[model samples]
Target: MYKLVKPLLFSMDPEAAHHTVSGGLRSFCKLWGGKRLLRTAYGCEHPALRREVFGLTFRNPVGLAAGFDKNAEYVEEMAALGFGFIEIGTVTPRPQPGNERPRLFRLVDDRALINRMGFNNQGVDVAATRLRQLKNRENLVIGGNIGKNKLTPNEEAVSDYIQCFDALFDVVDYFVVNVSSPNTPGLRALQEKEPLTHILNTLQQRNRKGGVSRPILLKIAPDLTHDQLDDIIEIVRETGIAGVIATNTTIGREGLRSGERLTAEAGGVSGMPLAARATEVIRYLATQSGHAFPIIGVGGIHTPEDAAEKIAAGATLVQLYTGFIYEGPGLIKRICKKLVAG
Candidate 1:
């Protein structure tokens, strides 16, 4: 079905295609027996596929990465497609319209996407409400990927993260502190040791309050140096955060086969172009940290083998975004089957 539909979607603008597909799925799943039908076609279950990570039981280790469902609008819709988890938002405390149009682009030749969408979202409160209203959350593990507003200065970024964390703490299963997106001006600066420690420590302090705390993970850029990753290990240990999401997206365009025009587009590149580097980061973090914490590996996973690669490289879980767009929902089931077969 996706093979038949792919060409038509490819003809539309990348972002428009995303909206169309999201809307179509939401509407389709509303019909009688709709969710059951989708489950029949796409869902996979096996004891071997189940995983216990960060004290959470995942039906499988495959997850829908953030950015795809930035506002928590499609949690149930995506859950029906056989993901073990769904992450929503790079949400901010206040609503902001992100970067300009043509912010999301598809590089068909290289099976990649360059997006400068910034952190455009409807704010954390809206996402929290939508998540709170989820009626069929059985076995659903949702993560809130939180970030600062673009307009917020670096000095005040901790407050924005705190606000988002508090608003979403009750609703999300886990929290991903996002200081890694390259699109937001000066946002990556927070990844530095001094400021990054401040933000995580602040969140960790709040997370311990009220006798309940969620697993907090740091999402880091693939562009980080070995020194930076070492610092990341130190930070995770120091802050007592749960783990790390090895990569966000990379600004480097080292080996893209796409034309110069598309490659020159200013944003982070994700998809096949990021596969090796992402896995490398995961392995580094795992080995360097002596496998002390879980890692959610995501980037350039367009096949079951790619998913397996992340796991083999020490990713406790794996996620899909560009690969989900390019390979369709069947990719999720295929990955689960492969894991079970092993």
Candidate 2:
């Protein structure tokens, strides 16, 4: 099991182990009667877990967030693990190698992660190709979280988002415009009002004219002030966009239990320490916007209580990234079952 292998995995370089886990899943799922076997093992058969949102029906409410499966590589494998939905890709119009190594770190004592991975992905075209090959599933909703390449100047960032939208329209069920990753140089600046409006407005126009008009949502960082969050809510309403993912990861490191050793690691923080801040953002969004649209709450959700907090705060659905790394697959079932039972 993962518990036994985790120590070995923890010893490897974080990024390398990430690729290894993803690659290993791909290989394992290819073996004799593989993917179907996973469904039997990891799947929850309860009907109470089903829920509908975003005009789609999810088998469960828990989803795997974008960074976990960036290139659309293991949707089938992850789907087997009983996540109701999966958002793949912070993919760009073009691919880049991302930030340098040691870019990802485990703050083990705090049950958190700090990663400076700068949207390194295999480009939208490559991801779209694989996505197109997926056996269609109306049940398991897939969200495509798209972003610009790191080297692209922020001025032309909208072009990258637009291209990714056009390319992945036929494949993904929903879209998340990711402008909040801390690792990307100058990317978070796009979340500011003027630039955020420009990027979202362009995508809204395209979606209106497109073949399959999937719902589009913006993902925001938790570090924003009340004024900035108000700008975000205004833009969401103005653009007639779908919704918001309440948070990305946090740039702030205040009051972390991981101590200063982790304080020195230059990256975005997520996991248990992020729970209060992310839920606070969700609650703020809920209160400010008059509950205008849906919200996908993510960050530090590793327990049934955490999931409940997200729902209570106003997230129609929730996602997990660091939680999965720390708590393993059981966390999904636990959260989902708790939600369903309640």
Candidate 3:
């Protein structure tokens, strides 16, 4: 069914297709028995696939990475597809229209995607409202991937993150401080040791003052050097954050068969080209840190082997974005089946 539909979706502009598919799924999930039917077809339940990480028990380890559903509009719809977890947002304290048209590109030949989506979302408040309305989220572990507004300067960025974290703390099961996206100007600067440590420390201080302290994780970029990654490991330990989401999309475009025409696009690249380096980054962090922290490996997992490879590399859990787009919803069930078989 998806194979027949993929051509039409692929024919449309990438971002437009994204909205169309997401909207359609949301509608479908509202229909009578829609979720049960989807579960029967795509859900794989097995005790071996269940995982306990960061104090939350996941039905499985596969999660839908952030940026697929930037807002919290489709949590129920995505959950119906059988992912153990779903991460929403790169959301900010305020809403903003993202980068200009033609920002999302499909490099079909490479089975990859490039986007300069600039964390476009309806702000954390809107998402919190939507999350509060959901009645069936108990089974799905949700992570709020929080980021600063594009207009916010580096100096005051901590305030933006704090506001988002505060707004979403009650709703999401966990939080991800996203400072690695390449689309936002000066956003990656927040990933540096000083700013990163400050943001985490401040968030930790706030978490300690509260009711049920939710897990906070750091999401890092794949483009970092070994020294930078080492710094991140130390930062994780120092701040007492839950863990890290290893390897966000890369700015690097070397050896892409997608050619200069598509490769020349200015944004982060995700998919097959990212798998090796993403795995390398995961391996480096896990080994060097002596597995000191939990790492959710996410980059270019399009197959069961890829998921297995990430786990072997020491990822406590794994996530998919580009792979879900390329392989369809069945990918999660397939990956879980393989994991169970092993």
Candidate 4:
């Protein structure tokens, strides 16, 4: 079905196609029997695929990564499609329309996408309100990936992160500090040792004060050097972070089969071009940490073999975004089925 519809979606603008699919799914899930029908067709559940990580139980290790539903609007829709978890946002304290138009582009030949979406989301409060209404769905685990607004400078970034952490404390299952998005100017600077430590430590302190603390994870870019990854590993240990999401997207457009003109478009590159490098980062962190913390592997996963490579490299869980767009809903079931078969 998705293969048949691919041409039409491909014909539309990338961002427009994204909105159409999201809106269509939102409407589809609203139908009386829509969720049931979706699950029957695309959902795959098996005991063999169950994973217990970060003191929480996951029905499967396959998750829909952040940036897909930036405002927590499609948890139910995505859950029905068989993802064990869904992460939303890169949300900020205030709502800001991200970078200019034409920020999202597709590199058709490379099966890749270049996006500068810039954490555009309806502020933390709105997402909190939306999430509060989802209390009834106990099986779905939601992760809030938080970031600072564009105008917010790096020195005061911790406050922005804390605001989001405090606002979403009651709703999300885990927290992902998103200081890695290239589209947000100086955002990646927060990933530096001193500032990153301050943010994570501050959040940890607040988490401890709460009645039930939620796990916190750091989402990093694949463009970092080995020395930088070493710093990240140390910071995770120092701050008691739950784990890391090994990679956002890459700034490097190395070896893509796509046209140079399109590849030259400024943004982080995701999809097949990102697979090996992302896995390398995951393997580095896992091996360097001696498997100390859990890692969510994401980047260029279009097939079960791609996912398996990440697992073999050390990812406890895996996520999909570009592959989901290209391969459709069945990718979730396909990956989960492969995990079960193993």
Best by TM-score: 1
lDDT of 2 by residue, 284-306 (tens): 99999999999999988988899
Worst 10 residues of 2 by lDDT: 131-140
Which is the winner by lDDT between candidate 1 and candidate 4?
Answer: 1
Q: What lDDT score is found at residue 260 in candidate 3?
A: 89
Question: Candidate 1 versus the native: TM-score?
Answer: 0.99
- Find the 10 residues in a row with the least total lDDT in model 4: 133-142
Q: Model 1: which ten-residue window has the lowest total lDDT?
A: 131-140
User: Scored by CA lDDT, what does every candidate get?
Assistant: 0.95, 0.89, 0.93, 0.94
Write the residue-wise lDDT of candidate 1 on 1-342 in tens digits. Answer: 999999999999999999999999999999999989999899998999889998899999999999999999999989999999999998999999999998999988999999999998999999999999999986989999999998899999999999999999999999999999999999999999999999999999999999999999999999999999999999999999999997899999998888999999999999999999999999999999999999999999999999999999999999999999999999999999999998
RMSD per prediction, one decimal?
Answer: 0.6, 1.5, 0.8, 0.8
The clash count of every prediction, one per candidate, is 0, 0, 0, 0
* Candidate 4, superposed: residue stretches over 4 Å from native: none
- Cα lDDT for residue 321, model 3? 96
> Which candidate ranks first by lDDT, i.e. highest?
1
Clashing pairs in 3: none
lDDT of 4 by residue, 108-222 (tens): 8999999998888889999999999984564888999999999998998999999999999999999999999999998888889999999999999999994789999999999
Clashes of 1: 0
Return the clash pairs for model 2, or none.
none
